[model samples]
Target: TKIKNEFPVFKNKVDGKKLIYFDNACTVLKPKSVIEAMNNYYQNLGVCSGDRSSHLLSWRVQELVEQAREKVREFINASSTKEIIWTKNTTEGINLIASSFPFKKPRDEVVLTLLEHHSNLLPFYEQGKRRGFKIRIIVPNKDGSLDLNLFKKIITDKTALVAVTHLSNVTGLIYPIKKIISLAHQKGAKVLVDDAQYIATHREDVQKNQMDFMVFSGHKIGGPTGIGVLYGRESLLNNLFSYNVGGGTVQSVKIHGNNIKVQYLPPPAGFEAGIQDYAGIIGLKAAVNFLEKQNQEEIADYIEKLSHYAFEQLKKIPEIKFLADYQNQIPATLISFYFSDKKVSLYDFNLFLNHELKDYFVAVRCGHHCAQPLHQFFNTSISMRASFFIYNSTKEIDILIQALKDFFNRKK
Candidate 1:
């Protein structure tokens, strides 16, 4: 409740407007606990080389790091802490594994879906282009849901990996991950879930689902930027090869005139190559604490109700088309729409929303939203999206509705 006061962004008005943040689909506002944790990390506990050093201060910082990792492990229910690998963000986590996977076999296939974020797509696509592995793209349902039946057809004995999103960033559709994982495991395929947009918002029981890997971003969930998690199974972690090498990964190295051998540490440390963002990680832990303090079920319900109201109100305008069907129970905080006039470019609509009403809401994104493929299925030229968070209220939705009405009424 007092979170808005801590985030400095809310303190200032834009073009004489009070900022209403609805752009949570892209990133969320951080709470005071997160901010103070970050501040304290540098303001007092700042240090270098968290684990390699022996000094009290350095070890203390390392303790903080481990504590943060434990928080993530507990939050996601990881069987073993060793399985969690820290990355810069969800993008790096996906790419690191995708790029570094040891292609020790003659036949290996990687499966992706159209519902994937680009972070999940391009990495595998690049791997396919470079390494001779077969890449298959599973199609989404007409309603933007993932088609599991389609997955059963493409997965084969040769399939090595399956990477998909737990939730669609654009469509607001949730995928059947447990079923997807079951289907993949039957074919000896490991799955990597892009929880970048899905995690921290939903209730996830990773242990029950038996998911092989899950990755998510910190900034998206109100933690500081430049930090994320890569959760892998213990068996998979043991066999995993690190993509990066630096201070933390190396135990020793032997150099020869023409050959070199570097001894690498095990999974978690081996994968975290360079210097880490200590403060950011600390802040991430606080962010997780703050979220845990709230009731997840209630939060999820609030978002859905707000989303439903926004959708119904938007539908009242005949000159507009919404991107999502109101019937689906995808989280409602985000509602995307378009103007019906042929003369109106999406850019114009976005510009109006961003510039004309910059103060009313702070979180809005315009265009393909890095989800171009999704727009094609919806048959939209472009979209103006308003996202919601715990801070948003129904009154704001009404304000948005009236704004839309005024725009169309004046134009006509």
Candidate 2:
């Protein structure tokens, strides 16, 4: 309850009841500090930030931007700020890497898993089509868990990269990324982890994991949308071909008698080609600072407990068939489940939770949750997801259970 008050969104009533935000996987509610930080940027310094300007506002903006970069670096325990590239979202970062990565065509291969989101899969799939690189897929086990032996068999010296999700959005299963990174390294393949879901409830140490590339969205955390991060090793980032080119990318461009010469800036600036989202960056910094102050370890433990509680509670409902691994510890903060009753559709259940359920709105995600392949693995078309965060509580879970019981009773 104390932590819940930090988010101003809870103050507002939805359909005559308090809002129960269970869609943390899609996007978490922003805290007051993050919102204030963003508003501060617009209100105080609404100017462009780059080398071209020397004015006071521009200098302040530049300082904030760099400070935010440093905060992110510290948050992830990155080696330096040069390794961080600001992007619009995780999708953009994946696309950037897919386009810019040095793929050696027919001989080279990229290893991916069935658990990847469309953002992680499509970029590499499309790139393979253009680059003629072989794409290998690792299928998960029957219960939505990965098999390391299969992964070992799939990854070989020909594999240039192993792109996989740190956590499954559909099943809410946290993959062992550190081990995955080790395996990829053994096979002389770089690893790119889609940390969109994992980073929300866990502390990410890119250095410890030795991750070559990592991508996530600010909105998945407590920051604003339209701002994300792509963390890559400095050397690898410098080697990558530029994804976007525009106003801020190049240091200089000279055109003399139709002979043009251009010198592009280094990694971060080169990758971030356009005028950046200053407010979003500032807001992300504030979000990181907020999380840091709260202590990520404690938050993680709390969320884990809440996840277990939710799992146990949801398991009581016989109709609920969970996609997650319920036999062991539930590492993920979310749970995805489906109904066996053909009469109860995913859409109607989500609708009841969001609007028609006893006047309160229990916000959840419906549909494939962007992991259609995983759904195919489970042999289902769609399911509903209820993801939790720091602000979520056991009381909310009880309410959700009661709501579910009410929903089922009404359906019957």
Candidate 3:
């Protein structure tokens, strides 16, 4: 597909082998359009944004930034640009909500699942420690799916927030977010979806989903790093306190006697303090545009087929043990598993692929994948992950399978 060629990295050779990146769950390779957009921003309108200056160059930069914000709003089907806030990544977005969301009393509860990345898990835990709120955790079923009934039972009147991943980065299992959001709203609780994995392949409409807030990282969606999006309900955002305060976030500052008064801007501006990552934001917009042209549904289907092909091929290996049944899951974009014979650790297998399989240039991830609790539940410290994206193909899956087969044969 031309889409593969759009990523210039694919043209380059690593160790004289064509790069076969299966780590989309970690970060995606940027398309030429995204790279060019970032370069253009640096070359042309490299100036401060917002009301900091009235110069033409500054205004142009501010216009580009606002245009990017509007594009993000449209991408996620947010109600307004005011609801879209710029963040460093999904981690910062979750932290913004964790630190600023109004929790009135000590007994206020924040619920999460076992499938969360550390970015979604730790901020709330730290906030709970400081704010004296109770944190309720819901463990997944044996098959790595959330028990909806158990989720309903755990969230009650005291629940102030429910944060969960839209899709599991490790298992590629999709959560019933619409149902979960409905239940949370019924209990007068807000919902935050970590779309770090989901956004790359699927479409997210915050208004349609009735999500209070949604977060995703730009790098995971073929954009540059250090840029992310936070989509909040306009009313909820206005009610929340500013996460960071500085120059661009304020509407006015006045000195009265010995005291100084600061009137912060509304919603997104108040949340985004100081200078922003203008180049990265532009790159993100370009990435989103590229994905939109490809059609999200088609991308999802292509990646799913690739993942299923990989799963079936790997299943032939008697020593392999899958963490979850991939065939029954919703469109597996990634798969995680460990070797049952324990002849080698996950890292050892990863090193074999990177070093011994240098000619094939297969790249995958290995570790806890920032969900140590989930790994603990599975009774393992680490596992290997092979994630897929639209640019990947069944041919690459075949290459991967052949490499694994060769490894096993040699070991035997």
TM-score for all models, in order of appearance: 0.94, 0.97, 0.97
Poorest stretch of ten by lDDT in candidate 2: 323-332
Per-residue lDDT tens digits of candidate 2, residues 44-152?
Answer: 8889995547888898899999999999999999999999999999999999989999976433899999989999999999988997787899988767778898878
lDDT to native, each model: 0.80, 0.88, 0.88
lDDT of 1 by residue, 1-412 (tens): 3646757777877777787777788888888789889999888878964577778889889999999999999988998789788999999999887887755564488998877777888888897788777788887766566667888999888889999999777776667899999999998888999987777567676798898889999988889889999998877876766687888898888989979999898889889887789998898999888888876677778887897788778878899876655354554357777877757666665556657764464346777877676687777757888877777788878877877776676677
lDDT of 3 by residue, 259-349 (tens): 9998999978898888899899989999999999999999888888887788888889888888765444643689888988776666766
| Model 3 pairs whose backbones collide | none
Off by over 4 Å in 3: 325-327
**Cα lDDT for residue 161, candidate 2:** 92
Instruction: List clashing residue pairs in candidate 2.
Output: none
